[model samples]
Target chain A: MSWLWGAVIFWLAAWAFNVWLANRPVARSRAVQLFIPALFGVTLLILWEGIVRGLDVPGVILPAPSAIWATIRASLPVLAGDFVQTILKGALSGYLIGCGAAVLTAIAIDRSPFLQRGLLPIGNFVAALPIVGIAPILVMWFGFDWQSKAAVVVVMVFFPVLVNTVAGLAASERMQRDLMATWGASYWQTLVKLRLPAAMPFIFNGLKIATTLALIGAIVAEFFGSPTRGMGFRISTAVGQLSLDMVWAEIAVAALAGSAFYGVVALIEKGVTFWHPSQRGRT
Target chain B: MKDTAGIATPVIEAKGMGLTFETNDGPVHALKDVNLTVGKGEFVSFIGPSGCGKTTFLRAIAALEHPTEGTLTVNGMTPDAARQARAYGYVFQAAGLYPWRTIAGNIRLPLEIMGFSRDEQEERVERVLALVDLDGFGRKFPWQLSGGMQQRASIARALAFDADILLMDEPFGALDEIVRDRLNEEVLKLWARTEKTIGFVTHSIPEAVYLSTRIVVMSPRPGRITDVIESPLPKDRPLDIRDSPEFIAIAHRVREGLRAGHGDEV
Candidate 1:
């Protein structure tokens, strides 16, 4: 009861403080802006821990945040192995290969209308297929290892990258193309100098989308088949043993990894497309 | 000047030239049986109403649009061949600068494509930047600059290759009157300095009169040339010369020619 009361009172105080800070002129400062979100996140974790402990909830049903954090610290080696198996080996490799192949395919399709008509429909069909159904087949083909998970990730991420890159290649204006032609620019020259640069914003859009899909596909495919390792394998096994805290720990790792992955891509996009209206400062 | 035919083999020549666009609505005669010749170091302005083939003729000369009926040659070669030869530079109505690139990079683009040495490219970029009075602004991106300055950068890009002929399609059409007048003066000075043959397209009568050694007045609805007014004004012109009687008379004639063309349409 005391735990419950403490969490409730702290949450209310934090909420009031956030409201006050948001209204102040000092809120516009960078440190204050960052502090607000950090404070909100801490409050949520404290409330979650308080609710679990105060009610004397069974750990098997829902683990407390503190318990999950403890598990994370204790199972560092296992978690590190899982991160390398799933994130580094499976998701990262698939992301690079899938995105590279997609860009190359997009350029090939752009070169020929025949391929554009033939390949785009096939890509759409492939994209429409269920990941669950394809994952089992891919696991059997690539075998029960990180390779199969990588294949699944490739399948999941390929279409989004292809479609976005194709659209991006066409993003250049007619006036820009005409200028290229007037300069007697060759096809490759026009592509490298004008169309490709023009298409970068679109390409980055695809790449960012592929990052999330890579993680999801890599994790999900492991459920169909995998060795006695990886995030998905650990999560499935941990749940069966009623070790929900370990499951929560794995989830925490996934969330952090996913967010960090997305943040890195977004940072690169800001650097590449600083000229775009969306990226520029209002002033 | 007209009688000096054998002197230098005209810079651009068209004989019974025409272009008919095969749109979904059927064939539209964008140009019909046009004939014109531009000599070396001459500034020629093509002026007419909206539907007139002023822009079409310029595009045809640039090899962007093909003439359907007859022959059009640039620098003693077909327009396409001349384009391949890098015989001319073209400036469009809009600046069309790539947003990703700085002004200096945009100017260097054509030079890169044509395979100029790196040192020469840098030298040419600096010279043209100064040529357009954008001396210190090369490192700035296109979006950071005003519309007038961007247009000037585009002009610098066209001039970078040092092509003998400059084909400009309503280059100052989007600018305010003050900017247009200022750019018009700069263009005259550029032409005088470079001694490049210029083919200018515009709808403004005063702009046509003030800038051209010759004005080709065209009419639409089966677009054709109606008048070719050669200015008797001397090569050396000051901005105040626009207030002269000769300038007003040329402007009034251009207006009358435009009205006569409109009379045919309605």
Candidate 2:
């Protein structure tokens, strides 16, 4: 078809342009660096739109990026309410409580050797339980509100942070500890000065992993039951009604929001653990 | 027990020390009835074979490991009491610099722990950095520096607090021969300036002979002292000293003693 021919020509042109751009001479300016990537992403989007329209794909199966954008513009009020309810209220609160409690638990476990032996197994087991399995039970227990969603998130996030912190606390070298011992440093002094700072990279690793988890938990928990305002509820209900365009719009929002949340945590992690080798930029 | 008030008395004196670790093969005696004394402002080196108790003995002195059957005192006080009194500094095999900290900041750790005033901490950091020849590299992280530089920083840290005793455990074991020679001279200069009592542990024969006033060579199984050699080298040393017949003789003697203790095992 003429449409297929046009799409292929455009794709080939974009590919050639990408290859040219990547192999360009060093004398190229900085603006080209930004422009090249933007050009590729836009080309991909345009190709997607062209193919879907050319094939006459059902809206339920696929929505063009422009169609998704129009739907999002029309439903800003609904989407904003969901974002507020799910992310700001539920996910944020759950994240703080869960991470704080894990850190405190890690300290306690580090103190009592008996607790470390007995409790770490339970914490690891708890971490392995699926969010899908727990969401319904938590909704039943916390009674189908934002409270249940937060509880699910807390369950989802608690162990990774705790285990990573405990492992980090133990990661300081023997010489470092011996130096403290020779200095006549008290147990508290050594922990405060050496072990805690050494544990920072691991703690940030756990925090970054937990960020995406917090988002996932908040959204999934809404599927079991909620006040019909959260993201999970809208997504599930829109799918049932075959409002594919609305679903695509909500997905676009979730992807952007989730990415933004993850990016912020990663930036904070870079600031906190700049000494870590993993954070060093080779390029 | 050593005397209570005389500054000339031995700063650290151990009477009949013993250490035994219970293993799957049964009790392994790591140290046994080892008696030694380190006097004020003396430089002593503990040299021995791999399994010998030189490190164990020093750990006992630091109160890091307890001796099972003897009393040890530092400056007429218990090891724990002496540590609390901040009587000594220790440098381990690695530089033990915190990777997160800058070179100057790692040197400042002890001062920070003791709550030194901000101005005093800065002055001390500046002084020690220069003393170690690491001036103007204050803000560079530990990982950014080479091994020799990091070890120099570690030495600077031990000297920063003006503590009168230093225990260094194979501090230059990882460096090349050239760097080790330089560090050995620098450490001697530091000792002369500060007049600190130093107890060093090493496995190298030439190293022991070069820097030590007295070298205590030890043997392994149920680890015990084999020989104690007093060096005849003058206080002021020259690079050409290594080529001197006197240095070679002492080094050969140490190697023989090490072989006497170690080679018979297999």
Model number with the top TM-score: 1
lDDT of every model, 2 decimals? 0.93, 0.86
Q: Could you give candidate 2's per-residue lDDT for residues A71-163 as a string of tens digits?
A: 999999999999988887778788988999988899889889999998899998998898889999999999776888889889988999999
Query: Interface RMSD, candidate 1?
Result: 0.7
What lDDT tens digits, residue by residue, belong to model 1 across residues A1-283? 9999999999999999999999999999999999999999999999988999999999998889999999999999999999999999999999999999999999999999999999999999999999999999999999999999999999999999999999999999998999999999999999999998889899999999999999999988989989999999999999899999999999999999999999999999999888888788833
- Runs off by more than 4 Å, candidate 1: B1-8, B264-266
Q: Residue-wise lDDT of candidate 2 within B1-266, one digit each (tens)? A: 22234347688887887888889999889998777777898788989877898998888888888877888888899888888888888888889899889999898888888778999999999999998899998999998899999999999999888888898999999999999999999988888887889999999988888888778888898888777777789877866788899899988888777788775564
Chain A TM value for model 2: 0.93
Q: Model 1, residue A273: what's the lDDT?
A: 88
* List of clashing residue pairs for candidate 2: none
Q: List model 1 lDDT by residue over B76-121, tens digit each.
A: 8999999999999999999999999999999999999999999999
Query: How much lDDT does candidate 1 score?
Result: 0.93
